[model samples]
Target: MDNQVEKKKKTNPFLTYFKDLGTAIAKGDVSVKLSMLFMGAGYTFHKQVIKGILVTLIEIAFIIMCIFYAAPNLAKFGTLGTVQFEQVLDPLTLQTTVNDYDNSFTILLNSIIALFLIVCFILFWISNMKSVYRLQVLDNEPESLTKKHINTFREDVRSLFSEKFHLTLLSLPALGVILMNIIPIFVLIAIAFTNYDQAHMPPNALFTWVGVSNFKSLFANSLTVTFGYAFRKILGWTLLWAVLATLTTFIFGILLAMLINSKTTKLPKMWRTLFIVAIAVPQFVTLLLVRYFFGDTGIVNSICSNIGVTEFLKSVGLVSQHLNYIPFLSSEHWAKFMIVMINIWVGVPYQMLIATGVLMNIPSDQIESAKIDGATNFQAFIHITMPYILFIQGPSLITDFVKNINNFNVIYLLTNNAFITPDQKLANSNAKEVDLLVTWLFRLTNDYYNYKMASVIGIIVFVICAVFTILSFTRMISGDREGDYQ
Candidate 1:
């Protein structure tokens, strides 16, 4: 019997689906067959007046939608329309006439909507057929009409508010997610497969599906070689920045928290308050201030000049005598270093606060035992505190890394006005040495209107972030070593 069950479980899914479907069709009563054809015939035949009416109304609405929207859009979805707007002489008035063109945007949008509706309709049709078969089976069980109809409705309503209450509460949010999140994601994925760039943009120009060409173009052609190079450089920097920023901020934040929590530390609150003040100020304002302070003629350079640091550097050949100002934000390497250092400063406070909370939760017994074992403060931290913190903050660290990969505001706000010589820019790409993939995507869309390239970059960024996050979570969960020390 166990062997037979195992064989059955190994049977092909499609074969099982077909066998079940055939059985449902063959055993269904006449009303069930009619309901399969008309959507509400079984309910009406069973005298389920309200349910039958609602089902029938849904069928009518679906038919109306197919006629008015789905049919036309699905037809045009093939070519995305071929007609072009033209200017011609009007024979009647002997004047110039403009004829309407095929709007590819409308065609694509409507086709997507039609496809979504069709999927929904298919699901509803399946449910309707299944309900009809179930009702027929119930009918054969000799239930009273009141029990089948009125009592059934009452039971459904009661279940909705009781056993199925979560479903009822989630229905609106599910609908919102479908409309907003799911639809937009589908649209973005679809756009990545098309030539929907500046030259091929809407009504005036019709863009068609060029499946995988946009992706190929990113690495294949001379025109995009520069973009490919820029992508490689930016991606390298992004990974480096994420790792360095995450580690620097995390380490310093932990150390700061430890200092504040130390009995030997004086005026801990004052030190914490000073650090926390960075977080209290608006990030944009802070970034802007930092940018100016490090600019060529800004306070830092001015102070260096006033204190003769600039002259000293020139004498030592550290800076050229011809250039009187330090190019902190202007030079690529300098700008990158400054941005990372500034990020560490701005990001450490939040991590410090988190570390403070996490530190309190560490077992004092473990630390005291280590001390009694003649372990120094460093040894106690390395063995006990570090493991505890890592176990608790492992997932949070991964999240912070992902956030820093897409940390656009820091890079953009600080370097937006900083002058990068044209020689330093990517040959044909709208990317600077300091721009991350996210910042490059922003420049592509906002500055250059290169939607195709932007969409491709966006997809790549999402894939990279998703892969890292998934791998990190899998390691954290599957390793199951969180409580090993405990």
Candidate 2:
């Protein structure tokens, strides 16, 4: 049985598909066999001229797409473009003209699009062939002998509005995904295999496939450019930040909500409104204000100095001896600490609101039972409230963790120009002390124009995010744990 299973696994789907096609043609009537070459043959033979004409037109369109669109771009796909982009004297026209240059970027993009079209056409062709074979079978039936009884044009149109409305609804969205999401992803992957950096930029220069050289550079370390070193540091901090940011907000937010809901707390509504106001104000504006307040010469620094906090930090070796002001956003450890604190400040309010709704629905019976069993509020919360919330909010918690991994705003806004790396290796790799992977990708593409490496890093970031998201979601959905807690 295991041998049989192995044989089944080894069986190629493509081979089986073609084998079925060949058998259909061998056994089919003349029209079915001819449909292999002429898409309309079987339909026209059955007197469905309009349907046959549509199929024939589609076949002609495929041919035109291949000849006009796919061929020209694919022919240049290998080298991406031989001629440099420039104007020169035309030999035939005897006038200055632009050279027939291939843009590496455009050729690369168009070739991918053409390839996508061909793949889609191939699937359609296979389905078309199967359809024609089915027509052949129907033609053999006595009831279908007089004429083809395919759906009428009106029926087809009406079905699209009624029974098949989902197709109508999703067609435009599917097209948008292909154009805006899928094709650009393929283009990014394709460019990762080539030399598409500032030094080899298109229009002025041509880039060709370098074949994993960028990937090698990204992983391999050198004296001049320590990519591997920077990757390790940034990745470490990214994970640390993600974990801290996610957990701090989550745990603290629950506590805050509980405190607000407590009977002993005074003016709970007013306190809640103040926290809500913090969230209501724009997040970037808050971050920018925080950034200015924490600047070296800002008012906060003056307050810290007047309050003797700077001297206390100097005694503890946090503030530099030469500097009178606290380098809250300038020093590496200090900046990282401040970013986490500020992120907690920004994120906790939102978390508290979410937790508020969840805490209101904490299964009153469970809490009452914990109280009856002589459990204190802390014990009851530990055993009941937290578990109930976790059961209800597990998926959201997983998403929050994943979101924090790519959390660009807090890291970027807090650290961009505020913190500069003292590490030579990080600076060599065009990285700073507090750069997250997403922010690093931005700097690489937007500032440095090191797109090749950026693409590689982009891919890495995607992989990391995807892995965490998938694993967390998979574990969350794997079993009936929700039954135990909720």
Supply the global lDDT for candidate 2. 0.87
Best by TM-score: 2
Badly placed stretches (over 4 Å) of model 2 are: 1-27, 87-97, 144-149, 265-270, 475-486
Q: Give me the candidate number with maximum lDDT.
A: 2
- Global Cα RMSD, each model: 4.2, 4.6
Estimate every model's Cα lDDT from 0 to 1.
0.84, 0.87
Q: Lowest-lDDT window of 10 residues in candidate 2?
A: 144-153
Error of 2 at 454 (Å): 0.6
Write candidate 2's Cα lDDT for 60-159 as tens digits. 9989989998899899999998989898897898999777777888889889999999998887777777777776777676774476566655776789
Q: Candidate 1 clashing pairs?
A: none
Candidate 1, 356-439: lDDT as tens digits: 999999999989988999999999999999999999898889988999999999999999878573543374788888888998
